[model samples]
Target: MTGEVAGGRVPLPQRTAEARLIVVARAKRAEDYDRVLDVLVEAGIRSIELTLTTPGTFERLPALTDRYGASVDLGVGTVTSEAELARAIGAGARYIVTPVTSAALVAQAREAAVPIVPGGLTPTELFASWSAGASAVKIFPAGQVGASYLKDLRGPFPDLVAVPSGGVDLDGAAAWLAAGAAAVSVGGPLLGDAFAGGDLAALGTRAEAFVSLCARTAH
Candidate 1:
């Protein structure tokens, strides 16, 4: 199954490498999701991930892309199963991320040359995913392990594209990137119920700061 989404697209690895910061927004409503998208766009954040667990994401991806695709690399996170992969492609997901590695899914992505970032926790698991053709291996629940662990992982897997997701914040985003992460995913801190609260301005500020912080660390 070729993995190309509706539009002929750029590959995910290129997008991740170019994106200094990736914002993962988990929201319960379309309005909230849109609000977060707006903030991220306004703040010059070019990469955004709307997790499958986020309510209204499936309904919102297309519209969001229609409006923001020119400036953003829109993606779906926490994706599992071939059905979700097909749906995400239909919704114009430019990138796909999963909490675990699946060979079938990797094959599906590779068929179309689209990027697939699979999650893995251990050295063995991470390398396994890499060997399976994952564009990047996500260190899920990274906050629990901390940036120091990333430093250690890189020592052995210097060429690996390790993305530290979950519990990552603006303060640690730089550290992760500096440690050789292709990119870092920041959520909770960027949205933090602000969307549900309808606080777009606050969300915008947070997004801008996070972008700025990532930029600073990247250089």
Candidate 2:
């Protein structure tokens, strides 16, 4: 990957390499993101992905981007189709993430100069996404494969840029980074119950903890 991403922006992979973290949120409703995101932003999270599974995300995304776009890389994830990708870009998604390895999506992102991180679980899938020009490939269900899975992958794909997502806790996040993961994309484990009206203070604490942990392990 190039040092500068398309559109002359810092590549998402570089941001993740430096921050070593990407916090993903899948709120039931779009309005719930405001408070949840405030806590994350305050905790110094630079990469944040809001999924399309949440209702009203496309409609409310523009405002969210307007509010936090400059300070953070506000992205859209769980993208499944060309229409959604178009809508995400129109709504100001700084980066695009998919649940599957798709070269088409990566090309689309390039057309808009938006970085794309496509998800895949197996080694072949992961390499395919990276080869297709994705900023990085997400290791979905990384917990099943464990942290060492990334290390093993590096044996064959020494320069592979990966972000382990799904079922990762604080320790698992550290483990992934230790194994050469570009970043750890954490969701439920890090979010806890923040969107379920859980404690924002507690959420902040967790976020801060992950941020500190990643910073300490960052290469």
**Which one wins on TM-score?**
2
What lDDT tens digits, residue by residue, belong to model 2 across residues 68-153?
87777878899989889988988888788899988788877876777788999988899888877788889997888999898889
Tens digit of per-residue lDDT, candidate 1, span 24-140:
877776666665677678878888888888778888888888999888888888888998988887788888888986877876776666778888788888888877777778898
Candidate 2 collision pairs: none
Query: What TM-score does candidate 2 get on C-alpha atoms?
Result: 0.93
Give the whole-model CA lDDT for all candidates, comma-separated. 0.77, 0.85
Worst 10 residues of 1 by lDDT: 1-10
Which segments of model 2 are wrong by more than 4 Å? 1-10, 13-17
Best by lDDT: 2
Model 1 CA RMSD to the hidden true structure, in angstroms: 3.5
Candidate 2 local distance difference test against the native: 0.85
